[model samples]
Target: MQDITFKHTLPVQLRFNDIDALGHVNNSVYFTFYDLGKARYFEEVKRSPINWNDADLVIANVNANFLSPVFMSESIAVQTATLSIGNKSLKVVQRIINTDTKEVKATCETILVGFDVATSSAKEISVEWKEAISFYEGRELCK
Candidate 1:
C-alpha cells in the first residue's frame, strides 16, 4: 500500500452520531469518508460537476478493512486514487487516516461501473473519463 501514491485527500468531519456505544467511530461511517474522497476526486479530475440524478458511475461493490479504531479526539482524512479502469468499470482505492499521526485506520477498494439511468444498464467507460483519470494520476491506465 505504501508504494501506491494518492493525489487526493479529503478531511473527514466527525459527528457525534458517527460514534457507537463502544466509544469509537462506527464502522459503517467510514464509507461516507470514502464517498467524500471519491466525489472530490471526480470533481477535480473530470473538471465537470457531477449530477447525482444522472451519475456517470454506480458502485458495484466495496471491500473495506478496518485497521484500527478511530476515537473522537483524532482528526481524520480520506485519501483516494484510481486503481484501474476497465472497458465498463473502474476500481478505486481509499484510505482513512489519522491526520496528525498519519496512521491508516481503514482501507477500502470499490468497483464502479459506468451506468445509464434511463436504461438502467451499464455503459462503456468514456474516453474522456479515462483521459481525465490518467492525466490526474500522471500515468497511463486502462488496457
Candidate 2:
C-alpha cells in the first residue's frame, strides 16, 4: 500500500438514529459519513458548489473495512484524500477516526468514473477537474 496524507477532514456529528442495537454506530451509516466527507472535499477543492444537473462523475466501485466500533459519545471525524487519477476515473481513500484518541474506526476506498450524462456513457475526465484536484492534493495526479 502506498502512503497517503489526508488533506481534508470533516467532523461528523453523531445522531441517535445512527446507533444500532449493539450501542454502536451501524455499519451501513459509515457510508453516509464517507459521502459527506467526499462532498465537502470536492466542494473545497473546487472552490464551488457541485451542480448535480451537470455532474459528470459517478461512483464506479467502493470497498470498506470496519476496523472498530464507534460509540455514540465518541468524537469522530472523516479524513479524505485522492489516491490516484486515471484517464476516466480517480481513486479516493477515506477513514473515520476518533478525534481524541486518533484511532481509526473505519476505512473506505472508492473509484469514481467520469460519465457523460447526456449520452449515458463513460467519458474521459476533464482537464480542468484534474488540475483542480492536482492543485489541491499538492501533487501531480494525472496518469
Candidate 3:
C-alpha cells in the first residue's frame, strides 16, 4: 500500500444533524466526515497538471469499519491517507478521530478508478498523480 497522510479538521457544526436521541453521533454519519476529508484532499492533489474540476476518476468502491462512536460536542477531524496505487486505480485509507481526546473513531478505505471520460473506459493512473501523492506521503516512492 502506498501511504500518504492529509489532515482536515471536520467541524462539529457539519455533524450537528448526527446527534441521536441517545446523545451520540450516529454510526451512519461517519461517512459524511469521510466525504469531507476526501473533498479537501482532492483540492490539494488537483493543484497540478490535473484539472480539479475535470478529473476522470470516480469512486468505484469503498469500505469502512467503525471502531467507536463519537459524541456530538466533541472536536473531530478526519485524516486521510493513501493505501495503494494500482495500474488504473488507487485506494485511499481514512481515519476519523476525536481531536480533543486523540481517539480513533473509524477507519475507511476507498478505491477510485481512473477512467477515460470520452471512451468511458479505465485508464492508467498518471505518473504525475503518483508523484504528487508520494511527495505528500513523505516516504519512499510508492511504485
Candidate 4:
C-alpha cells in the first residue's frame, strides 16, 4: 500500500449502466476506468509513441483488490503508476478514489507482456518502453 507513486490521474463518472441492482457500481466497471487511466497515463504522462493496438505489449495478468463500493453519485479519479517492469512483462498498479472525500473505491495491478505483433508471442520488453515508463514514474523503478 503506502500509496504507490501515481504517475497519472483521470476523473471518471459512473454511468447508469454501471450500477447494479444494489445501487453500486458493478465490478466490471473498474476495468473500464483502469483502462482509461492507463491510456491517459501513456498519452499524457509517458507520452509514448505506441498506440494501444500497435504497442508491443499486452496485458498478461491482473490482480485487483476492491476495498469499497463506488456509487454513481460520487466523483472518482483513477490513479495509475508503473508497479514493476520485467523482461517480457510490466506491472501497473491503479487506484480509484473519491475526489471529494478521498476514499478508495478500488485498486488493481495488471501485468502487461511484450509480444511480437506479427508472431503473436512474448518478446523482450523494449528499452524504449522501459525508459518511457521510468520517466513518468519520476524515480528509478525496481528491476
Candidate 5:
C-alpha cells in the first residue's frame, strides 16, 4: 500500500470502554473515529452548515484493514482524504495512526452515494458538491 498524503487529520480520544479484554482498542471503535474524520472533513470542505440527519449522501460501502493494535496509552489521529468522485458516488480513504510515532494502525475506504430522501432512491452527484470537494482537494476529481 502507498503512503497516503492526507489534507485533513483529526485527533481521536480513546475511551476506557473502547478497549476489549485484550487490552487494545476494539476494532469496531475505529469506525467511529473514521466517521468523525469524515464529518470534519466535509464540514471544512463544504464551508457551510451540514445537517447530518438531512444530508443527501449515504454510505454505500466501507472496508478497512487492521495493521496493528491501538493501545489506550497512545495518542492517535484519523487522517482523511477524498480519493475520487464518480457519477453518483465518491470514494474516501482514511487511516488511524499513532500520533506520537506515526504508525498507521488501520486503513479504510468508503463509498458514499447521493440519495434522495423523499423519493427513496439514488441520485446524481450534485454539481455544487463536486465543486466543493474538488476545490478543497485542489484537484479535479474523476467523474
Candidate 6:
C-alpha cells in the first residue's frame, strides 16, 4: 500500500446502539463511519454541500479491513483521502483511528463512479469536480 497523507479528518461519536453484545462496535457499524467520513470529505473538499437528489457520483465498490476492535469508550476519528481520479471514477481511502493513541482500527477503500441519474448510465467526471479535488488534495490527481 502506498503511504497516504490524509488532509480531511472528522471526529466520530459512538452511540450505545453501535456496540454489539461482544462489547465492541459491530462490524456493520464501521461502514457507517466510513460513509460519514466520505460525505464530510467531499463537502469540505468541494467547498459546498452536496445535494443528494441531484448527486452524480455513486459508489461502485468498497473494500474494508478491520485492524482492531473499537470499544465505546475510545475516542475515535475518521480520516479520508483521495487516492486517484480517473475519467469516470475516483478511488478514495479512509481509516478510523483512536484520537488519543492514534491506532488505526479500520480502513476502507472505495471506488465512486460518476453516473447520470436521468440516463441511468455512467458519465465522465466533470472538470469542476476534478479541479476541486485536485486543489483540496494539494496535488494533481488527474493523469
TM-score of each: 0.96, 0.97, 0.82, 0.92, 0.96, 0.98
lDDT of 5 by residue, 1-143 (tens): 46556889999998999999999999999999999999999999998768877788899999999999999899999999988999999999999989999998999999999998889799988988899999998989866
For every candidate in turn, the CA RMSD to the true structure comes to 1.1, 0.8, 3.0, 1.5, 1.1, 0.7
Q: What's the distance in Å from true for residue 77, model 6?
A: 0.5
TM-score of 3: 0.82
Error of 3 at 84 (Å): 1.9
- In the range 65-137, model 6's lDDT, one tens digit per residue, is 9999999999999999999999999999999999999999999999999999899899998898899999999
Q: Which 10-residue span in candidate 1 carries the lowest summed lDDT? A: 1-10
Q: At residue 122, give the lDDT of candidate 5.
A: 97
**Candidate 1 lDDT, 1-143, residue by residue in tens:** 54689999998889999999999999998888888899999999988778789887999999999999999999999999998999999999999989999999999999999988899999998898999999999988797
lDDT per residue (tens digit) for residues 1-143 in model 4: 65576757899977899999999999988999998888888776555444667777778888888999998889999998887888888888899999999888889988988889989899998887788778778776648
The lDDT per prediction is: 0.92, 0.94, 0.74, 0.84, 0.91, 0.94
Instruction: Specify the poorest-scoring 10-residue window by lDDT in model 4.
Output: 44-53
- State the local distance difference test value for candidate 2: 0.94
Name the lDDT value of residue 12 in candidate 5.
91
What pairs collide in candidate 5? Answer: none
- When 2 and 4 are scored with lDDT, the better candidate is 2
